[model samples]
Target: MSIRAARERGRRETFARLERKYRAGEYEEVEAEARALAAASRRHSRRRRPLPQWQARVLATGVAVAHGRGTEVLPELEALIDELEPVDPEAHVLRLIVRNNRVTVLNGQERYEDAETEALGILRDVTRLAHLTPLWRMELSALGALAVALCGQDRHEEAEAIARGNLPRAAEPALAGLHAVLVRSLNGQGRHEEALAEARRDPPHQDRRDSGLLDLVTAEALHGLGRRGEAEAAVRRALADCERHLHPAHPRIREARTLLGRVTGEGPGD
Candidate 1:
């Protein structure tokens, strides 16, 4: 199978196992299983042909990120970019993917300024290729990352505008993530009603982690709107879902727990 196909298949299989574990109430095993899957994916190498060497490395970088080794992957990704042949169009495309992933890693790390700068640079470069079909997905990825970084910087209005403007009409996973970012930006701006509306929109998929995040955003929006009872319930559900699927120490779990506390008129907890 091609690298992308292999990666997708691995992810689906891993998520299926995770769901089984979750349904069996084996929450403690979920994180370890996820990490193991990521490690195994990184170790499963295919011959480099239909996919370029850099493309394979990008896939490996994604595995590293899944294993929470993004910091370690970034320098290596940079080195790969530096080694790329200048005139190679395929290399250029892979470079854009690498750069976009770098911004994503930075955003996850909460390095807002750095992410913002990198995302902007990506946007500039992508604009030149905006009309090209192959680069369109990368453009969308960069836009989503830029919106997220803007939210991290507390620039809620701009983030919301960008996210809303760029949101795809199709029910693609990437668009779902962008919609979540839009919901977060709305919540940050105290537009609770709007945030809830956005959250209520159809999601791209039923992925547990994404669903949990959507619930968390919904809970915060409800809380901001003074619907304490509903907020608490939403947050509780978010906490349960997230804890079942994510690492115990995952930031999303902590955020959900903190929101639950606030909704209950208590300070942040757990």
Candidate 2:
């Protein structure tokens, strides 16, 4: 192989390994590993090798997010996105990824209008670049982010329409997020029965992250239906699952706690 091809292969392999570790919930480990890689890449850039720095930055940003650093990373990601011009296919794809990351962080920070606007822009680009088959997954991810943003803003009907239209086509990795949006949006619209029915249609999720999210929405639907005891039970389970599986600072953990308070009527809001 050419020298450039060999270097690219090595980088791709390293990134794939990091991706696997991140998915397995080894957040601290991934952070350390990615940081080390980023440092090395920076050194290479100084020597005129100019390795792709965005990959490391994206991984590190993901780690920060797991630790509930949405507010911290928001501006950094924006700056990085600005630095990345769509001058070529590689740069274009990297910019899209960073933009999507920004949208996700905005949603986590409860800046729903901004997230919605960013996601809409991302969707426009993804559609315009539809010839890139690999971008299909990014398109789904952006759509999911947009749906969540809409739900956050209480635009339930629009969110529900987006979820329902996309859920059937979502890949396995994107299923839980889109499903959560759908359930939450239904509950927002006061369609508790329909929301509960839809929640039940999902097979039991083995991953705690997925289960915890579904549990939260189920609790909301149950609470709306005046099933107080059941709602409390579901919310408590959701809180436990989130506490066990998510980062201490994860927005979902806070969300579960808030819902718990509402269900019990003994915590902060109540």
lDDT of each: 0.71, 0.82
Alpha carbon lDDT at 270, candidate 2: 31
RMSD, each candidate, Å? 6.7, 2.2
Can you give the TM-score per candidate against the true fold?
A: 0.72, 0.91
Error of 2 at 130 (Å): 2.0
TM-score of 1: 0.72
Q: What is candidate 2's lDDT per residue for 79-155, written digit by digit as tens? A: 87877768666777878988888888888889999999999999998887777546878898899999999999889
Model 1: how far residue 136 lies from native, Å:
1.4
Per-residue lDDT tens digits for candidate 1, residues 194-268, read 899989977556444354877888888998899989888899998888776655545576677678778886886
